[model samples]
Target: MRIGFVGGGKVATAFGRYLHAHGLAVSNYYDRHEDKLSHACRLTGAHPCQSAAEVAKMSDMVLITTRDDQIEGVCRDLADHGVIRKDHLVGHMSGAHPSLILHDAARQGAAIFSLHPLQAFAEEEKALADLPGTYFSIEGTDPRLASVEEIMAKTGNRFFRLLPEHKRLYHLSACIFSNYLVTLMACGLEALSHSGIHPEDGFPAMMPLIQGTIDNIARLGPPKSLTGPIARGDVTTIEAHLTAMADPSLASLRQFYAFMGLKTLDLAIEDVLQDPLKANALKKVLEMG
Candidate 1:
């Protein structure tokens, strides 16, 4: 396929480089920032186009790697410019927005798809290396599904299809798994800092435990993998933690802990590790403050 990119950000550069590395034809690219456009084209060996219309004219497939808010605008521009051809395949790489954001292009007779990589891309080089073995969530017309599949296959990745209505929930799950996990770790580091443990020291000390917990989850799955004071129904230990977080300055953290403890209690009961009485006792203690 003759592919083109409309934005020269990390994702655009990463996808372009990966396709080029795999011997696919990445023909042209366009970006508002001249430096970024030049860098992306250099990385992918693609010709630089001065406008989105030029990019559309040079390629059979156009991947819009712009920010989520800008995707529809770019699509509208392509349609208004008469850039999108009936035979063109157009897609955006956003987990939050569904394929419908490309409605302008679709209205102009282009096939529309949403192609989201279920991995974080902090840097282009890392993204290029990590694209393989990644899972993608794709939503599109049936006729263009095979085209998206072929692109994913070339990168050694797998994909599953989702309905447009499910995209928000699907992206929420991804946020909980990837984004919120980082926030959770930040919370842990902050709590440790109160005891004079620097983040540098805390992170190293916590990694093994974190990795072990992840391994347990992988091996046994959620409730079965849960192991902690709450899971053990240790009301006394739970009370101690609550007391430590009771400072007025830590009101939010205290509530956070309590809410999570209540959820953990549910897991304990679901896993058959605690009877109703024990679970109720744990819940009562978590709710105490």
Candidate 2:
């Protein structure tokens, strides 16, 4: 199939190069930025088009690799130029929005879809090589999507369908796991630094424990997977933590700790029988908040 890319930036470069490396025909590419066009053309050895119309007109499939907010505008541009053919397959690579944003392309008689890889692309070479292990959340009802599935499978990536309505929440879950976890780690590093531990020195020490906890979650599931103070129903340990950090500055952290402790206690109560005395102590401390 003759494939073309619009907005040939890092993602376009990565996908185009990876596809061509795996023996797919990446016909041409187009980008508003001359530098991006030059770089992508050099990487994929594909011709660069001077206009979006040119790329859309030449290819059977067109991937809109622009920013999420620009997708609709680009689709409208293709429609205005009468560039998209009735049977052309068009898609974007945005995770936050669904394929419905490409409705203009569909209205132009093109088959539209969204296929987002659940991986960050900081560099083209590394991303192209590692992208195959990435999972894709795809959304659309186009019959030609079968061809997309075949090509994605060639990359050895997993593909799962996501309804348009579920797109935001599905992406939100990914953000919590990937992005928010980074934020969580940042908080941990700050807390360690506040206690006079050098962040660079401390972070590495936590990596193995974090990896082990992740493995436990995978194997045993939550509640059962939880360990440490609250899981053990160590009310004395909890009170000592609350008492040791009773300063006003640590009040917020203490509250957060107690809230999380109460949550874990609930999980333990459901999954593990706890000593009645220790349970009562924890409940009293948590209730003091």
Total clashing pairs for each candidate: 0, 0
Error of 1 at 279 (Å): 0.4
Q: Mind giving the per-residue lDDT tens digits that candidate 2 earns over 219-239? A: 998878878777787777888
Per-model TM values vs. the true structure: 0.96, 0.90
lDDT of 2 at 92: 90
Off by over 4 Å in 1: none
The ten-residue window of minimal lDDT in model 1 covers 272-281
- Local distance difference test, each candidate: 0.88, 0.85
